[model samples]
Target: MPVRAVVVFLNLLLLFFLGPSMAWASNGPAEPPRPALTVSVQQVDFVEMERILSATGNIRPWQDASVSVQTTGLRLKAVFADVGDVVQAGQLLAEFDDTIIRTEIDQTRAAIIQAQASLEQATQNAKRIRRLMGSGAVSQQEADQILAAEKINQAQLASAQAALLGQEQRLAYTRLLAPYDGVVSAKSAILGAVYSPGQELFHLIVQNKLQWEASVSSRHLSELETGTKAILHVGEGVVEGTVRQQSPALNEQTRQAIVYVDLVPSPLVKAGMFVRGDFKLGTREVIVLPRQALVLRDGFYYVFVLEENNRVALRKIDIGQSLPDGVEVLSGLVAGDTIVVKGARFLEDGDTVRVAQVAADTVPGMASVTASGAAFARAGQ
Candidate 1:
């Protein structure tokens, strides 16, 4: 009977300890597993966008003419041509005194005349001797001597004539004349001032035509073609031109190619002024996205777009030409697809997103619904 009481007491103690644990385990109905998290997302819609290739360059002369002196150490007699002067071809700009040259020519001409008179006398004697020989009145050796003397006199006359011709040609070089019809943009020659050979006296630019010369990177050179249109923005006005010349080689210093665009005749544009321009290579439909929507990670571009069933899908995009305002998605995107422009880069793929309502004017209804659904999924999760 004592054993029985002990066993009953042990059983009571065990029940006391186990009873609370069982009650605690049963407390609060088993909670169902929390739903997967949802992230709000939005889609990108396609729209018409202008695709352009842009560069900057400087305004320059259509043609530059440098009036250079041909001879050295000659004093300029008159320098009537100045900057802004209209000049025609063959118009005299300056002249050196031709007194010395004229004197030399006259002396040479007198020498030539004297040689000619002597030659005439030698020829007459040779003819008289030859006629006497033919009549058997003169010896053959005497006739030959007279003919030789006449030849020598003729050579002297020819030498004198050549000297006179040389002096006259040198005199002609004393006057500097306009090589082309152009406006003088610069002048350095002064009256009575000496100019060296190849010294520039005046700089001229073709008055009617203008060119926008821009240096472009070699990477952009392949797209260049004759007749390509370029738009130059100088200050507030726009200068439109067409590509008339493209260099086949790159510049040695900058490794850039020089491109020339012919502008419409306008007085407002001036040479040597820097300007920005856009060259249109060609046009193709591109997927345009707001710049804010893109995220750069690990040297790659990414975007998050909302999918049906409230799932946010992360996408890697290949970016193309990006302007100041937006970026162009060259690959991994298509038309009619929705991309989240706002708060897209902040979220991850497969994460539920809450999309705020955008105004109808701001975004299309279809895109907003897709965004809202993703957000609702995230909230429920």
Candidate 2:
């Protein structure tokens, strides 16, 4: 009896240690157990999205005209335009003292008159001398001297007339006129300061036109072209613009090119204001997933791809442009791949997940599932 009891106890100990192994071997490997955290799964889809390039730039005038004096040595008498004043083409912006110019012009005109009278007298003398040249009534040397005097007087008249015209033009320069319709951005003209030739008096924003000069990377130069649409973020509002031109050469130091975008004149925008812009290259089809699906690990982006048997596998993906709707997956994912959108942070590689809802077109009750997933995401957050 004692031997039988000891055998029964040993049998019970063996069963306790090896019974579960025997059962597991008979049933084959048991399926993976699900995690406690419930998650939402979504299938990636190819959606048409606007491809945009983001860049920062400055606002400037479409045409900046420097208003300067063409003539010199005149005292500024009056300034009719100030900074921020709008003037039309041919409108007088300032005036110089015309007293000296007019006096010089008058002197030149008088000199011309004297020269003309002397030239007439010389012509008559030369004619008489030519008539007497062969008759010996006048010496050859005397006739030659008469002809030379006539030529000299004619040259003097021409010089004097040219001087008179120059003086007249200088007189006109005393009245400074707006070269075109523009808003005066800067003014340097004083009430009595004498201006020198080519001295800048005012800076004009031609036609009050503004433009955005964006410095973009040279890599994207091929994508941007003339007439490309861009949106600018201005103060408290947004402005639409069109690409007008691109720099022919890249900056040697920065490897950046200047993209000139013409902007409609707006009160909120001003020259030299730094702003942000988005260039719309065009539309393209790309696979996109919601932001919640992305997980950052060790500075790289990853997503939890749902596999068969409700198991999740960690996948590293390359990302591109990020939009309000979702993030663009450049690689490591494809359409029809199911990814964990919520509770991704709670998962590990090969973790079995309880998908409370699946977001897909073919799935029935998709609206309800999406709503529930949104609520679950909110709760998880």
Candidate 3:
């Protein structure tokens, strides 16, 4: 072969081999395509939100009284009321055996009658003594003695009258009367059972009016006051109530205080029923987002915030009161910040996402997105 042709052939062979190697070296390995996550986002904004304090407690009568006997050593003769029975003030609830009391009263009346007779006799005797003393037929000492006897009989008559009054009062105590309009909650008095003074016979709930005694944390005490409005959850219904009072001291163990809320009359409420309620403290401007937007991981709360170029940043936030519409964002968020509402659970920090919708329209399963990147566009509108 010619020398020039050989050189050209060698060069062509080297070019074929080196050309492929050089192209491979210049271009690094191909990158995998980034996964796109479909998400719905909403812009955080300041909304009119009310600060409410939630608490749980029991329903109890506004006024409860233990009815007991005032007079001692009387047998319960009859019970006019039983548990759950309604009663009125001054109405008879039970009766004690007043036979002994009546006899005592009769005896006192008889003693008064006898003392009156003696007093009248003594008066006549004193008149005669005075007449005789004026005529000098009786000695001054004898007349004075007769007049003293008359005074003694008159004092005896006064004592008898007072005794009769006490007996009469005791007789009246045998009939148990209701102190107020209330319902009988309990009964321990049995027919023919002897009872003593101060022994409870019946339990009465005044007016059947109930109050919710809720335990609230001490931190929220300053936000509550008497006459503050409250909503009580009783059974399947809600009843309006008012904050009537609160305990001055906190519980030693729980460090919580008792708040009493007087409920308006409702058939659903009764004494001893467990209830939950919320106190409406007041309204304030707050940055809020939908509950679905929040993602709870470990022990903290987080939200996926949208950034430039379809990227998301996981943000930790301090949550405040949870309302019906959304949750109050206490911190870690600002007004007009776009946050992922739906499909945030499947995301991680700094993940690239394709926003399916924005604002109210951004809700999961929604069909469209707005031009302003609204996650809750319908909500804002």
lDDT of 3 by residue, 67-122 (tens): 88888888888989989898999999999889998898888889889999998998
User: What digit string (tens of lDDT, one per residue) describes model 1 on residues 245-323?
Assistant: 8877888999998898999866668877888888877676556666777878899998876666545678899998886
Q: Mark the regions of model 1 whose C-alpha exceeds 4 Å error after superposition.
A: 1-43, 56-64, 84-86, 134-145, 206-222, 249-260, 266-275, 309-311, 362-381
Candidate 2 per-residue lDDT over residues 78-107, each given as its tens digit: 989999999999999998888987888888
lDDT of each: 0.75, 0.85, 0.84
Model 2, position 212, has a per-residue lDDT of 93
The predicted structure with the larger TM-score, 2 or 3, is 2
- Model 1, position 368, has a per-residue lDDT of 41
Cα lDDT for residue 125, model 1?
99
Q: After superposition, how far is residue 230 of candidate 2 from its true place, in Å?
A: 1.3
Q: After superposition, how far is residue 6 of candidate 1 from its true place, in Å?
A: 18
Candidate 2 TM-score to native = 0.84
